[model samples]
Target chain A: MNLKIEKVAIDGVLVRMPYNPAFCADEDKTLLHGGVLTALLDSVFGLANFVAIDGISSMATLDLRVDYLRPAKSRADVMVRAECIRQTRHIAFNSGRIWFDEPDQAEVARGAASFALTRGEVSIFDAMTQSRSSK
Target chain B: MTPDLATQQLRKVPFFQFLDFTITELAETHAAATMPFAERLIGNPIMEYYHGGIIASFMEAVAAISVSHGPDLQPPKPINLTVDYLRPAVKGALMAEATVTRKGKRMASVRTACWQDDDSRPVAEGLYHFLLV
Candidate 1:
C-alpha cells in the first residue's frame, strides 16, 4: 500500500513522510504531544532508511540520541531534515534535525540514529491492520 | 511480563539507562501507559514544562512497548528516535501511545505521542526504531 507521505524542503535535501497532528489540542493550539514528536522524528529517520536501503528488510532502532534544542513555538508548521550518513553491511547510521518554519534560525529538535539491517520476513498485512482502527 | 522484568529490560536500553529511569506503567500495553515524572528530568525551569530530556525518555518508553507488542520483535531495541516538542509539560502525569510502524526480522519501527491529560494536546511527538539486536 502507498503510505501518505508529506514533503517539506530544507537545506537542499528533500524530506518526505506522513506527519499530521492526528491528535492536537484545540485550546492549546499545538501539536498532539511529545510522543507524536518522537513518532515524526522516527518517521523521518525511517524514510531516510527506506530511501537509503533497498529490498524488503526488517530493521530496529539501536540508538536514537536526540537533543531538544528548544520547544516548538506554538502553532507553527514543523519540518524535519534527515540524511543517511552511512550504510554498511547489516548496519546503517544516519542523523537528522527538525525545525519549525524558520529553517536556518530555529530548531525544534535534533537527533542521530543507527539501525541494523537484516534479511527477514515482513508482513504488510500486519503493518496495515495494526492501528487503522485507532486512527 | 512483570514490572521487574520490564524494569530490567528498560534499564538495558542505552537512552533509558542514560537517564537512570525505571518503567512505571499505570496500565498494561494495547491500552495506555502513564509514566510518572521525576525531579531529575527537569532540565529547563523546574516549575515550567518538563525538560526536553525527560520528554525524550517518555517517547523512548512508548516506542519500546509499542514494538515489543509484535511477536517477532523479540529482544527489541531502539535504532532511532526523533522527537518534536509541541509545548511544555507542567507538573503531572505524562500520557503516551506507542504504535508500531513496521515489524520485520531485521528491523522494526514504532511511532509514539506524549501529552498531558489536562491539555488534550501532546507536548511532543516521536518515532522510535528497534533493531532485532
Candidate 2:
C-alpha cells in the first residue's frame, strides 16, 4: 500500500514501488508478477485522471487493456507514468507505461484504460479523506 | 500440466498469494477459482468495493490456469489482457471461471468471468491472449 509518488505534473504523475517478495510470482521470484504491474498501471492511470479532472468527480475503470512487453526484474523499483490522453463528459482515456529503475528505461508493460466519471458525487479525493479520518 | 501442478503454479504467484486466491477447479480446458473478501483488497475504502485491477488479476489467473492445464502442459506467458468491469464488486467472496477458447502452436486465447454472489451478474469479464513458448 505504500506507493511512492515520484513526481506530479500537469500531464501525468509518476509512481514507484520497490520490489518485494509479496509482489513476485511464485513460478519466478526473480521476476515481478504481471498482476502487480497491472495494478500499478491501473492506480497510476486513475491518479492521472484525478489530476486531469482536478478532483471534481469520482471515476471508475470501465475497461483496461495491458500488453506485457518484458518481465520486470526483481529487487528493482518499478515505476509507472500515466497521463490522461483525453476526456469526454462521461469518460476519461488514459495511457501509461511501466519500467524498472528509471523513467527512461525500457518499458516492462504498456496499457490503456477508460474510466467512467461520476459527476456531483463523492470523488476519489473525498474517499481518501474519509479513509484518513476513519483511521 | 496436471491439475496439481497448475494449483502449485497458482500458489507460486505472489499477487495471488497477496489476494489470497484459491484454485477451486482445474481441468484440460476449464478452470475456476475463488477470492475471499478482505479489507486490503478494497479499492474504494468508503464504498468497500474490490479493486478493479484485482478483479482483472483474478480473471487473468484463472485464464492462465486453464491454459496451463491444457495439452501443452506448460504455463503460457501472457501476451495481452483486456478486462471489462461490468459491476462494482462488493465485499464478499468472488468466483471466477475461465475456458480456453482456442489453442494453437504459438498462441492461445482464454475468456474468463468473475461473479460475486450471482453467476448471472458478472462483476468482471476478460479475454487473455498468451504465447505458448
Candidate 3:
C-alpha cells in the first residue's frame, strides 16, 4: 500500500490512501473490499503508536477489531485518522476511524488494536526512519 | 460450486485477483484458499513478515465466500470482525480456512484461521460477522 501521511503529531495522525483499481471488489471497480480498509487501519495504527509512544525496541500487533459501518464505495481517496490512546510498559492501545475524502466525509469503518511492545534503548521509530532514509 | 468453478468466479473480483489466491476447498458452510507471497504483501520491510491486515483480509475474503456464494449475486454485508495474531508469517504461501459458525435470516458468524506451514501453528485467527439481508 502506498500511503501518504497528511498530518502527524503526538496526539494522532491523518493518512490518505488513493483508491486503486486492484483493490476494488467488483468488476466495475465501484466499491472497495473491506479488507483494504482493515489493512489501512492496521498500518495507520502502527504509525500512530510509533509517534505517540516514546522509546521502544520493537512492537507487534496482538489483536485488532474493526467494524464496517458502510460499504466502501467511492472513487476518491480514503482518509484515516488514528491515535494511540494508552500505553503501558509492555503494551499499547490504539483507536482509529476511516472515511472517504469527499465533502460528506462519511465514515466507513472504525477500528481498535493492541500491540505488544519491547522497550529498549533504541526506538523502533529511529531504526525505521534510518533504514528508510538510507535506502 | 466446484473449486475449479469457484476459482473462475473469484477471478472477476479485482481484490481477489490482487491477492492472487486460489480456492482449494469449497463446501456448503466452509471455504479454503491459498495465497502466494508477493512483495506488495509484506508489512515489515526489514523483517519481511506478512502484514497482519493482509492475513485478516485474506481470512475475511474466505469467510465472505463461505457465507455468500452460489445464486446470490449480492455479497454479504460485512458488519464487524476481530482478529488475533498468533505468529509472524514468513515469505511463503499462506492458507486460510473459513467455517460458518451460525447463519440466521439476518446475520451470520464465521470463524477463520490462517497458516503458512503446519495448521496447528496458525498465524492468525479471526471471527467475522456479516449482515445477510
Candidate No. with top DockQ: 3
Ordered list by DockQ, greatest first: 3, 2, 1
Ten residues in sequence with the least summed lDDT for candidate 1 chain A: A18-27
Better of 2 and 3 by lDDT: 3
lDDT of candidate 2 over B1-133, digit per residue (tens)? 5555556666656767788887788877898888899998888776789988888877887888888764435567888899999999999999999999998989999999999889999988999999988
RMSD of 2: 2.3
The better candidate by lDDT, 1 or 2, is 2
Measured on C-alpha atoms, candidate 3 has an lDDT of 0.92
The local lDDT score (0 to 100) that residue B42 gets in candidate 3 is 87
TM-scores for the candidates? 0.43, 0.92, 0.96
Q: Chain B, TM-score, each prediction?
A: 0.70, 0.90, 0.97
Q: List the residue pairs that clash in candidate 2.
A: A26-B12, A26-B13, B1-B73
Weakest lDDT window of 10 consecutive positions for candidate 3 chain B: B68-77
User: Candidate 1: global Cα-lDDT?
Assistant: 0.56
Q: Which portions of model 1 miss their true places by more than 4 Å?
A: A1-13, A16-27, A102-105, A120-135, B1-133
Q: Which sequence of candidate numbers ranks them by lDDT, best first?
A: 3, 2, 1
